[model samples]
Target: MTDRNLRHPSPSPDATTSIAAEAEGFLLAQEHRSAAHREAQTLCDALPWLTTAQAEDLTRYYVAHRLRLSRQLFEASLARAEELRREYEARYLRLRRDLLRRHGAWASVLLACAAGVSGALSTLAR
Candidate 1:
């Protein structure tokens, strides 16, 4: 008869410890608390038949997926920020133009009044 130990070998303690350590590191590095919790749950739900290596592989897959999502979010936020910057710049230019127009109109009225006063004074002296 074939020996059962040879047919099915359990993972070594060191291997289990290494897998656990790597999983813990991955969880800690996660930025979102809820996403990390979900990943932890996924790991816990892994089948008992899975070997340490398989579990580690699954964990790595989850980490990679999370990283991809984070990159997408970062890109979206950057795009939104750039759009807001452009909008603010456009608004500032419009406000500046409005203020300059009003100031120019006021200055023209004041100059006209001053000229009228000077002409009347000269006519009275002659």
Candidate 2:
């Protein structure tokens, strides 16, 4: 018979308690309870041959793996947010510069026109 078909001995009381404690620790550390539950359920579903106790222990490891993935996703999202903020700041600066240049040009034109009008009035008086 294949090794898969052999009946394994049950874990000792000490081992069971250790596993339970580790599993409980993982559950407590998770920020999202629903996510941890979902991960446990998925592990149980995938290993139908496992006893309830064995499944519980395995689920803790699975939950830890899920947490690692979540951390990586959060890091990537934070990087993207920072990149978008910088792009927006640069665009705003460019727009402000363009507006200031236009305002300066208009002010220069108005001043030149005022000077011409004053010169014409002086000549007429003379």
Candidate 3:
């Protein structure tokens, strides 16, 4: 291989997956946009009295509003997901610490019991 090829290498599987995900997201966004436009058109259709320009303007405004709301919802969901991740991780750490402490206490008790048993046996032998 050439030096440039060696340095760059090929895309990893993860990179490919990321690309696929991006494409999928793009397609979904496009579909959502079309759906929003159709909805706006349907609303405009209900009002037959509007001029063509007025209808077009109303549709544009409606689509923009829908897009803004969708963006806000998506961002809020991402924030909530981040919060849940942090909460779960903290709870997991707390539970793990408690489990380790419990196990340590049990081990200490078992060690003391064995020592006591050996001491009694020695005393009896003497």
lDDT of each: 0.80, 0.84, 0.95
Clashing pairs in 3: none
TM-score of model 2 (CA atoms)? 0.62
- lDDT-based ranking: 3, 2, 1
Candidate 2, overall lDDT?
0.84
| Cα lDDT, model 3, residue 61 | 95
Where model 3 places Cα greater than 4 Å from the true spot, the runs are: 1-10
Selected candidate, larger TM-score, 1 vs 3? 3
**Model 1: pairs clashing at backbone N, Cα or C within 3 Å:** none
- lDDT of candidate 3 over 43-95, digit per residue (tens): 99999999999999999999999988888998999999999999999999999
Query: Which of candidates 1 and 2 reaches a greater TM-score?
Result: 2
lDDT of 2 by residue, 1-126 (tens): 667556776788999999998998677556555677686898699888999888888888777777777778768999999999999999999999999999999999999999999999999999
> What's the distance in Å from true for residue 53, model 1?
2.1
Output the number of the lDDT-best candidate.
3
Taking all chains together, each candidate's TM-score versus the true structure is: 0.58, 0.62, 0.81
Collision count for each candidate, in order: 0, 0, 0
